[model samples]
Target: MENKKANKLIDKILENLDKTGINTETLIDDIKELRTYALEEQIPLVVKVLRYTYEHIEENNSFLIPTLDDEPLDEEGDVIEEEADSPVESLKYLLSLIKNLKNKVNISDLKEYRDLLKAY
Candidate 1:
């Protein structure tokens, strides 16, 4: 079924995201494939997020820069900055956002996230 295919693709994407070195090209292709299913399922939020992720990786050769709040706070309450962008962390954050939207797509929250993503 369509859901089964979509779930399989999602699993594959999650696994790739967790890998030590991700192939950006492959990941982008996979995301594009998943977007088709999301479109068919009428999940506009997922579609939009996936499209953004695809475009971001294609253009930047890296994941989107996560929001500052997504950064960890050190004991001194300062943000723990990374010398370079962490694609894994950003991808995981994207997945978390998708998961949250899957349960219930809140219009206000969606707008907020859209703005946040656009700011990047």
Candidate 2:
């Protein structure tokens, strides 16, 4: 089945990165499992994470930024910490993660997440 929403999401991410000079190809590599995680949770993974982050902040000013430690090191082979010194830095890291999600996986695999995002 054609997944227009997934394609759109990919497009938006690409648009956002258009002039950032970020190495987008390396950002998105193996993401077949992100779809599975999204399906199982029945939520657009981004929305879910962001909501939890907002709620956590409202309930408590402190938070530990979510980690992708299970994933491999970044293109630079540098460790991405689960913590950031400030909210701006944390947001940047989260955006970077989203940008990286734009690769390798088929739209069919991303259908559920796309739908979740649409309904969101």
* TM agreement with the true structure for every prediction: 0.69, 0.31
Candidate 2 ranges with C-alpha deviation above 4 Å: 1-43, 66-84, 104-120
Candidate 2 TM-score to native: 0.31
The lDDT of each candidate is 0.69, 0.40
**lDDT tens string, model 2, 31-84?**
233333444545465545445443443444433343222444778998665533
> Model 1, 25-63: lDDT tens per residue?
788898899889889988877788778777877888877
Provide the clash count, candidate 2: 0
Q: Clash number for model 1?
A: 0
Model 2 residue 26 lDDT score = 30
lDDT assessment of candidate 2: 0.40
Kindly give the number of clashing pairs for every candidate: 0, 0
**Once model 2 is optimally superposed onto the true structure by TM-score, how far is the C-alpha of residue 62 displaced, in angstroms?**
4.6
